[model samples]
Target: MKNISKFIKIIKTLNFIPVLSVFAISSSCSNKINYNSSTDYENNQNFSDIDERDQVLNIIKKADFVKFDSEDINKIYDNFNYYTKGNASPYIKIKKSLQLFEKYWKIDKNSEPWVINILNKYDGPDITIDAINDEIIINKYDKNKTQEVNNYVEMFGDSIIINKKVCNFGYDKKIKTSEYGFKIISYENDILIPYYIFNTLFLSPNYINLYYDGTKYQLFEKIVNFDNKKFKNFFDCAFPGITPFKEIREDSYNSLKFLMNNYYGLNKYYEYTSWESILDKYRDAMLDINPDNYTGAYFNFFNSLNDLHSNIIIPSLFNYRIKYYQQSNKRKTYAKLDNQLKNRRSLILENSDQNTNFFGYLRNNLFISFDEFTQNMNVKGKDFELKNLFLSSILKLKNHKDVNNIIIDLSTNGGGDLSIMLWIAKLLSKDKEISFYNYNDLNESLIKSTLSESKFSTQYLSKDFIQAKNILKSKQVILLVSNNTFSAANLLTSIVKDYDLGLIIGAKTGGGMASIMPTVLADGTSVAISSNNLFLNKNRTQIEDGIEPDIKLPYDDFYDFRKMEQAINNFQKTK
Candidate 1:
């Protein structure tokens, strides 16, 4: 009977779920490619006049010679580690072995078809010999195969070489951020074979004869080679020394900016049809790269990665002004609306108008400084602290009068503590039981517990919910929101819409709506990933697209509030 009653209670709670919302957008830390027109390639005879050879020659001539230094090798290795995977336990052994090999390998000029060591197995496409032409020919496209080839005829006659070698770690061992460094492979067979293996891998490619001669070699564009031994060098040249993760991330952004400015012109890539308008001024730098080909190249690059957070930012110089203005406007608007918010504070209790002898109306400042309030408390799990503080203040003002109409000024709240949003809402609601569908990843092992595990389901917990639901039933709230209301704040706004709890009046909330996974590597370096999908309400509408507010109110419009206040005062007098 007890169990039955408990289940009934649970069912009831699920039915009356007070609009679950969160403005807090979580992000997975993204620690972060390609090529060209084929029609221009098939017509090689026309290309000779196109200075193709000379172009290659000039690139080689101007190409920066990157020496193999210990630091450079380490940087390359570091980068490789982030992308590749190795045995869970044997990574240390593998890295050590590769480092030793890289230290001994003698690097010099004229190492024909430069060979990168087979730190692991090369498993991409391989070449196939042709029968009719008495010459090698590689199949351009082959599905479910591990080999790629490029066959071309040079002045000397037929030439066959391998174009790409896709390598993988130990069988099904996923690549991680650390154990990705590689060792050099042999430069035999007219291909740079990094010691890796794929199916039917002994073969090479039959590609068109396109050579980068010594004169043109200097002008050839350079590419980064990653291995345990080359990571430090890559870091020093590309970014530089052990620095904060934020700084390293900025370097990646800058690198992308340079690529956009020099390689692909913006105007050609993202005109009215593309993201160029969104890019605004940065479009000019993008146009300078290759006005005609920039759009195609940028799109190709943007789609190269599957990670959601992987992206390209033009440059800080271009984005800085826009960001400054946005922030400045927000601050000014928040200040103007401060008094209106102050005037609407009310008591949280039921029918306590007579208690006015003890307490007056509450203050309107809805924003609380996290750093100041969390001084002594262990904030890690103190999700109820802020809302409880707000409720306690409201209760003190309950003077035996039923104060149902209220205003929550969320303009300055940057959003924190999801439970707090729910709790505060509960103070105004009358529902004894509020319910929401409990959704979660059953694979607990997939969840990284070091940062947050049980916390993800805090909203669904029974004990943590009742107070907030009760608050929502009786109070008709007008939440003053703005762009500053983010993450949990946004979630709160979403709840209002979904549950029909209240109305949101303000600018659009922040757009970050992804859930993140915080991880700490062996080196103590921490990073986050967006592993789980999140939703807004019980119906499970994914939150990444964000929740739309019921009413749109511009933060800059303060005069509009004076009229609203006057109307409310008149209604109060009539009552």
Candidate 2:
């Protein structure tokens, strides 16, 4: 069923224009045209009078019946059996099912112009196939309708052999697939329908099958149902000159609503309000089906949730319009604070290169600052390079005997790459094991481990334990955080506060501790939501509300190095 669905999705992109008009003119035009009845042959013309091409064309025009050689038909049957393991249907029964698809090739007045306009806009080439007298006639067309016809000698099970050149089906010529998966080649002017994909248009089911008999008729029935539904939906276009349909908008809305109800991590947090009422308010706006209304509804809904990791993406819009919903009040406060901090010239050392300036000494105190934790595994040795850079910084900090205070600044960091965050936590904490909690409605579990026990490709450095214990045991460690410190950064702050590893200063860290899960809706709208893996503190309390600072200071004062140093020293003295 999955393979059949994939096949249907591929065929939906094909340029299935009404080829009857092209065939009639390209063949014998002397034969009079009759639009009322398809079976009316002009003047009761005998088959022996015209050439082989004319006879095949006349048969297509009169009866809508496509003729194919016994061997060619057998090749289809053999491939079908091989792929389905002979479980679909017998050869005789499957042949009967093929007749149901002949009407799909017949001309329709309304669909022809719509399909052709889309094909022309996308620069998709037109193709026609005719099997006649043990050979196949193939016609290829450009956007201007310039046609070229060629006779193909042999047909493989999944491809056509033309002039000893094999054009394999089911695989894109430009975009090749590697062992890992599809590797994108280019996004422009690369629309070519493979033969196997066309075969699926006639063979596979396009809709869900409730009564699965494992027969070919069951599959054929689904294709017929889906085409009928799609044809009706074509008239429900949302905007003029735009191809998106109203049904697509409705489907997108319903699908996203379903996912939010079942899988979103913050469902319990919104228990104060009625979730159904909030969704009902947005439902009508989303279903209105215009571009502005649909996108606006999604934007408003996500903002109401106030989760930073959740958003909607419309790809057809220029540059792929993305809208994120976040805590409005918190963000507004942070924005004003950030502007003020930027204007002041603090005593902290500034460096343009983040990689080279992870750690530095500031008046007998060691400060480590990073915008984000990234492990670029796509680049050859990027992760290894980052690991070595961090190790060198840690070793330097460990050897500095004059350093008494360690300040980890994460004021503007938005967090990324969980494994890298854990690795850094292990290097800065004095304890041998770090502990946190993961909470879903179904279960709540504590996760405690050393860096060596990580499932990801992270290992403890050679002197990580020794260096961390030497510096952390005798000195005070402080964390500087702000509203922008979110996701994994937020989780790190919570861990520091929960385990008494450090003192937090500045404003509260922005809370976005859940892992993100992104999915594409039925209408091709991309949506991301916080997943069920919600982060929690050691007391089994939700960390989504953020962590408060132990020694809070104004944003402007926090930016001044002397003031921050004084606050840290005063807080340690009281302890």
Residue by residue across 472-500, what tens digits does model 2's lDDT show? 76777888898877888888898888778
| lDDT of candidate model 2 versus the reference | 0.43
In model 1, how large is the Cα lDDT of residue 145?
40
> If candidate 2 were superposed on the true structure by all CA atoms, what would the RMSD be?
21.1
**Model 1 residue 384 lDDT score:** 41
Per-model TM-score versus the true fold? 0.35, 0.53
The segments of candidate 1 whose C-alpha lies over 4 angstroms from its true place after superposition are: 1-388, 400-402, 425-429, 432-472, 517-532, 558-561, 565-575
The lDDT of each candidate is 0.28, 0.43
Candidate 2 lDDT score at position 155: 12
- Report the lDDT of model 1 for residue 268: 22
Show pairs that collide, candidate 2.
none
Q: Relative to the unseen true structure, what is the C-alpha lDDT of residue 301 in candidate 2, on a scale of 0 to 100?
A: 81
